[model samples]
Target: MHKIPSSEITPEHLFLSRRQLMGSAGALSVAALLAACGVRTPGAPATDTVPADARTDELGDPLNSFEEITTYNNYYEFTTDKQGVARLATGFQTSPWEVQVGGLVGNPRTFALEDLLAFEQEERIYRLRCVEAWSMVIPWVGFPLRRLLDVVEPRAGAQYVRFETVFRPEEMPGQRDRYYPWPYVEGLRLDEAMHDLTLLATGLYGRELTPQNGAPVRLVVPWKYGFKSIKSIVKIDLVDTMPTSLWMALAPNEYGFYANVNPAVAHPRWSQATERRIGERGRRETLMFNGYADEVASLYAGMDLRVNY
Candidate 1:
């Protein structure tokens, strides 16, 4: 894997300025003011225990503000409008959460929210490339998903991991829409789920996740598109056959099971060659695997990304 030079990293002072801007300016004014001032936002500080490599990605991009990340989201469980999710999910319940991990696991068990948090936590600064052709640099606080899976001990023949989100039509109005499926679902190959980069994010910016952000717990697969990282997880099943994801079920032609980020393969409606980074002025060239090709490219050595994507 390529290592980013220290000189390329954004300065700490710029991060402070960005944080200040987030607190003072409106969401619409943030990008303009920051660009004019030549300043950037900062992410939550990581503890000394966090590995140096986990503090930032190879891109050395400045972190997006808490306001932007929390306010702008793609959580369809709450709403389709990106900005409306935060407001709609405000009253949604996340407390007293428990995730059932069974299926092909030999030691299947239900992990409570507290139990999940009990695992050793680390900070990972990852770039979130959404399928919609937008991106964000997020400092996520969580442990590797492999750590949780290890305890359950996936049995032989467990080829894939299936994830299910909470189903509550009363709180999440979007769930009531019969046009789409309720209880969003996602899946990952066993190796992908076990990868070190795969995180079960509990929070961002050093604080507990809010309801809008998949609170309590969520999956963060940095190499793939943002939607692959399912939120508000309630069930996990290790199965032999590939599971059909919600988006795949909704639009099989547009959304595939392996939702990996591939700039070469454009979305049917739009080109994926470039992306508008949140909190930035203009678009930048999109990188294969969201700039994680060095780390995860080998996982698809014999496969075709265009076909799998």
Candidate 2:
């Protein structure tokens, strides 16, 4: 766990300005956002560069620039376009939010946004590997999902956890499309949900998350493909049976329930052997369990990852 230094964190003024510029400019390109915020455009010489060794994760991968992390996103609830989410999500409401935790729990309760924030927050620099062969090193601020789970103790026979994102078709235009299911949902095995590495992320880069980045709260399971870390979470449920995730329901042959990162198990359309890290030049070999096999591998002891994935 490499702690990010204060100097490496994005300056507050620049973060605010970036949001303001995006709101006023309306659907500007990511390059335009970077240039307006005085950040070097991708592939250009950086005028303000951090040390090569600074702001790295445990694997020593340098953190992606704040611009790259925020501007480049895969929030399907907003749109399928990666860079367009930021613009469309500018007005998505997050405050006054509540997350209901129930279903086979002893002390079922709904936690308000402020209540969720009250938990002791810490920064965990993590590598977010998308299933589309792209990746980013993000410094997320939040506590373990287990902390919240403990509050609503899982009763006996609870074997899985289900997560659902908030639904507002009026604000989220993509949800209005009838082609796919609305109110995205995901799930994890009970033990996987309790793992210390499973984080309910609230913010990134030392700032509260923006709508494009899953504002208010979201899940961050570092060892799994990025989609498993569901965004804009509003409901959590403990169940005795495996929950059918949105992706799994949509394309069962393509997406699986486990969703653990395994370089050997390729997606139906492409190989998962290598991924392009944002802000980096070339592709790098994908790792088993996203390089956290040592920590999470035992969770699937004796099970074939290729089959589960």
Candidate 3:
């Protein structure tokens, strides 16, 4: 794990102004500061040198401020207001959490959050492209999802992995909306779930995940849109067929099972060709699979992304 220099760490009072400081510090200082703080630009490869074992495919710009990352989030369980979800999530409980892994698996079992942490952890800084045309570069800490799947041992019938988020109406006000689906659900092909880039994130920026950021555990599939990375996950089921995801069920034409970031395939409502970085001034061109095409393109093979998406 890389540590930021104490002198370079932004003070609490200056937390809100960190973006301004980075923007004004010029390229040289910004590079050093971003590297120290684990932030990097998205269009280019990671500027900092991590340990060889890290296996992080971090590319592009410096990271958004921790404040920006936490405050500006889309955990619909709490609320749709990105700035308000954090406050609304205070009542949510993450402890005493156990993720049930069943379905088409040989050893169906429920693993506690602590048990999930027993495996070797790796840090991966990934670019998160939202379906709404926004993006962020986040440094996440977690082990590969495959590590957990391997323990349960998928049966021959298992072809897809379905994930379910916790549902507590009292704590999650959005449940009352009756518009969007509750207990947010998401799924990925078995191979996609087992990919090295797929992570069951427990923390970000060297800190444990906060309530708004999906405390306890969440999925982080860098090659797909941010929503595909469901939050506050409670159950992971290995199924024989493609699972119905919340968004896909609500609006299949807009959201697909394989929500891979593709500039060519625009969303029904708007173009996905460009995305506005939260703290940045303007939008930047969206990349193919958010710039992980080189590593994950082959997964699609001859399959048409337009159809799968």
Candidate with the greatest lDDT versus the true structure: 2
Per-residue lDDT of model 3, residues 169-285, tens digit only: 877889888898787999999999999999999988777788889998999999899999999998999998899999998998888999999999988888999998776766799
Backbone clashes per model, in order?
A: 0, 0, 12
lDDT of 2 at 236: 99
**Against the true structure, whose TM-score is highest?**
2
Q: List the residue pairs that clash in candidate 2.
A: none
lDDT, candidate 1, equals: 0.88
As for TM-score, the candidate ahead, 1 or 2, is 2
Ranking by TM-score: 2, 1, 3
Expressed as tens digits, the lDDT of each residue in 1-309 for candidate 2 is 999999999999999999999876775676686565564455433233333335898988888877777788999999999989988998799988999999989999999999999999999999999999999999999999999999999999899999999999999999998887778999999999999999999998877887898988999999999999999999999999999988988999999999888899999789999998877666899999999999999999999888889
Ranking by lDDT: 2, 1, 3
| C-alpha lDDT score of every prediction, in listed order | 0.88, 0.90, 0.86
Q: What residue runs in model 3 are displaced by over 4 Å at the alpha carbon?
A: 1-57
- Structural RMSD, model 1: 15.2
Comparing 2 and 3 on TM-score, the stronger one: 2
Model 2, stretches more than 4 Å misplaced? 1-53
